[model samples]
Target: MTGLRIIFMGTPEFACPTLRTLIERGENVVAVVTQPDRPKGRGQQTLPPPVKVLAEQHGITVLQPVKVRLPESIEQIRALEPDLIVVVAFGQILPKALLDIPKHGCINVHASLLPRYRGAAPLNWCIINGETETGVTTMMMDVGLDTGDMLLKSATPIDPDEDTQSLHDRMSQLGAELLAQTLDRLVAGELTPEKQDDALTCYAPMMKKEDGLIDWTRSAQDINNQVRGMTPWPGAFSFLDDKLLKVYKVQTASGAGNPGEVVAAGRDGIEVACGEGSLLIRELQLEGKKRMSAGDFLAGYKVPAGALLGKKDGAVGA
Candidate 1:
């Protein structure tokens, strides 16, 4: 455990806590590898990944290889002579060459219980599927996509109103703590690596912007899940007079009308009909407008009762 040379690999805010925890705990994090800076936001300004920022702040050597699997990248990592490589949400897949370089091999702090959500965007898919519980897992890394041997796992209940942003923040912290514990047991040689059951595995494929398009034909609860899962990203969206209408928060309500039809729009909220039930829109953002509560949105813009929402050309309830 003493003089453990660790090389950390990660990107995004989800990975920040783990990197921070390792550094703060005085672990020998010799170097950090993160995704390259990319243009972001409306200004198209290039920004470094959160991990890079944290690593630089601690004066750790930072690497941003475009392809970690490449010979040069692998050689660069091999030169570090790290005892272990810690990964979290590092956008690229690590080849076996790099995986085998570390003495203790690589470990990942994944955001879901393995053999379940075993891909990118696990947290988002878990909420969209209406899972009652979810958790984090620290695993021994392999070449396969999250198909790795597990080290430790910690579970948490999924709140009724939990959105991706809130769940992400909570899981990030949890993953950091769980990873720390896993490393302790690993260093002590007290942990057994458990093989994941392939039969129970489900993939959380990377999300796309089109995935946020709301299909009102789905049930109220399903739509609500979509709203919650897609928030702070490609937000759950329908159409209002051909303009994109992003639904930030919604709750199930009682109403009946054609799917996607506005059932009520008043001071309380805007109630929209779905195939199975209704949705009480609590917060939303129209294209080119700021996000606002349903009441605030209704104040300036009127959605007449019985007007249809969703794609103008698509068949209703298709």
Candidate 2:
């Protein structure tokens, strides 16, 4: 319903597109609920979510609740009397009370085809697990995490080197499109929500900084996926010459040697050994150095052939 009163719930950059799309389509967004600002970045500076900033720019009422369970927050939402509540990467587990506030109930724009990859960080896990195809789903929200009934789903193929950041950007736009179409069908009483088969559910737990450490013993492809999937935050790292060396980009290779051994070094990429396969590092950065090509790193530092990457009692590169 283009003119339907809606409450949009989201927090990250991925969610911003859906919120923007609703406003652009002239939907009656009564309020926007997002997570509270938290300290972020190297300096731990407090930062508001992109969605919050965008909402403020549009003069939309913004609510940053540390927790939505509080009575006043509940009352505030009830006051709006919204027809539907839309959630997208809201970064919080919504309570049952809030899920039932909207007359048509709350719906979520999830990044994966539901019943598979049903948890936080679906986009990253999909590539990490080598899935060739993934997509977006609009679902009826339940108390369980992403275990909702699917209203509409749209699929897309994943490129061999597609990372989480790029995939997220694409899904954000796709989710907005799906939500719009889902809403149209819903208003026309043509929407059919299919219950997700719980037996087929897979989880995508949140990624942690420790998860980015490179495990050289793993397959070259797995390490490569981890490196790219964790990019731009909690980057995959390995110890080089007793110092932390972060790997920003990498590719699989055919060579093999002792796991973590530097097989070759050049401007193209740094070839490193794995248990069964090997990986060529394209980009890297030393602990206190600017990001540069792996070849540049090779030129400055002696990461010569046969040098081991990770040592015991040393930091493990994810």
Candidate 3:
């Protein structure tokens, strides 16, 4: 509620909560800076980013810069005279020119506890790596990647069945709450910055579509994590008879056979043997078909016992 000249920068749905919180708390948000609208989905229709839509609804100025480091973009930000810059999942790096223009510098709402998951796609990587706990961090932005002093943090435990989409929703709201508290404490001058230990750093690189390919050679538990970690994005997947079969949910089971071999198939699920154990496929999407339960899939499609499943590449499973 202070008279700080705040400028919000973000693009995806993950950043919406923090912006909404600032607006609700009566922050003087002068403008919203987000990436340029781009084509998305099957239609390839160009649409405004969620942040831009939210900002427009609130009657805040929206800025879509192709490159935030451009001289014109830097001058545009400098013209705003922002006392503080708040960045969530903005997708663009703020150059030194724009960072220096803000009176209070820049504060970032990172999706992980730095310096643990300090790169892009932290949420997905945490689950993919089988991390039992993770959280959000508000850091004072710097030239380096999430290497700034941490202002505040909020942690949450990862559930056994948690996926990226579910965890993303929860963490988004949590981040908003934490950022509100951080801003209040900053205004009251009651906050002390904490330095992150670089030795604990682990990078979560940007994900690619191919990253979702399932390798049956791994343990059942590891493959299960990979399925959930990539959910609603690239999607963990394998091949059945040279066709793509996307896997959404799975449960570890006890079995012994060659990795990727279909040891059992029935109403409960299709039990496929893994390198160590096996996995019961609960949900999946086969090529030229809709996502369905294992039972429904079994009713029409046949995943016969002793059948192989894995990458399309020529291999034992293939």
Task: Please tell me which predicted candidate would have the highest lDDT against the true structure.
Answer: 3
Ranked by lDDT from best down, the candidates are 3, 1, 2
lDDT of 2 by residue, 23-93 (tens): 88889998899999999978999999999999999999999888888888888898999989999999888
Tens-place lDDT digits, model 3, residues 96-181: 88889987889999999888999889999999999999999999998888899999999999999999999999999999999999
Model 3 misplaced stretches (Cα beyond 4 Å): 314-318
| Clash pairs (backbone) in predicted model 2 | 212-318, 213-317, 213-318, 214-317, 214-318, 237-317
Per-residue CA lDDT of model 1 for 56-110, tens digit only, reads 8889999999999899999999998999999999999999999999889999999
Clashing residue pair totals per candidate (backbone < 3 A): 0, 6, 0
lDDT of 3 at 22: 97
Taking all chains together, the TM-score of candidate 2 against the true structure is: 0.96
Error of 2 at 76 (Å): 0.9
**123 Cα displacement, candidate 3 (Å):** 0.4
Record all residue pairs in model 1 with backbone atoms less than 3 Å apart, i.e. clashing.
Answer: none
